[model samples]
Target: MADIVNLRMARKARARKLKEAEAEANRARFGRPKAERLKMERELERAARIHEGHRRETPGEEA
Candidate 1:
């Protein structure tokens, strides 16, 4: 025979789990300082620019 489960408890558990996951994600996204975020964004842009500078031009075409 299979075990019987309480549907109300199961539903509350699922909701709680979802809320916790959302809170964790929010913490990661909003926990950083503004200056640190700006620094990271600038670094990423600089790296992208450096990468773009290293690309090769195709034959008979301008880069």
Candidate 2:
């Protein structure tokens, strides 16, 4: 029981470390700021708006 508990803790710790590393890498690459986030959101929304009319639905599938 003690070994199993220890193993679980070790696995959780490793996963947490990996997540933190990934977040840091993402921040470094993308440089998250409020302005940038808003800009990205607006760009995505514009793309969706532009493509809305171009989507073709499959037969028998109700969108």
Candidate 3:
């Protein structure tokens, strides 16, 4: 005896496969990944400055 499968389940499976295929294609075209980007280092330096500016507490200020 053969087991019957639901129709809706098959449609959902097809949609998920198509989305995965598109993501793979995009990765190949972009070439260098996020780790290799020069901008990453520059952004890190900029963030450090902003946080340091906020952390300074003035003398005699109320707790």
Angstrom error at residue 19, model 1: 0.6
What TM-score fits each model? 0.63, 0.44, 0.42
Highest-scoring model, TM-score: 1
Best by lDDT: 1
Model 3 worst lDDT run, 10 consecutive residues: 28-37
Tell me which of candidates 1 and 3 scores higher on TM-score: 1
lDDT of 3: 0.79
Per-residue error for 57 in candidate 2, Å, reads: 6.4
Q: What TM value does model 2 have?
A: 0.44
| Tens digits of per-residue lDDT for model 3, 16-56 | 89998888887765666777656766898899879877876
Against the hidden true structure, what lDDT does model 1 obtain? 0.91
Candidate 3: where are CA atoms >4 Å away?
31-63
lDDT by residue (1-63, candidate 2, tens digit) is 344468788899999999999999998768878888888899999998778758697458897
Clashing residue pairs in candidate 2 are none
Error of 2 at 31 (Å): 4.9
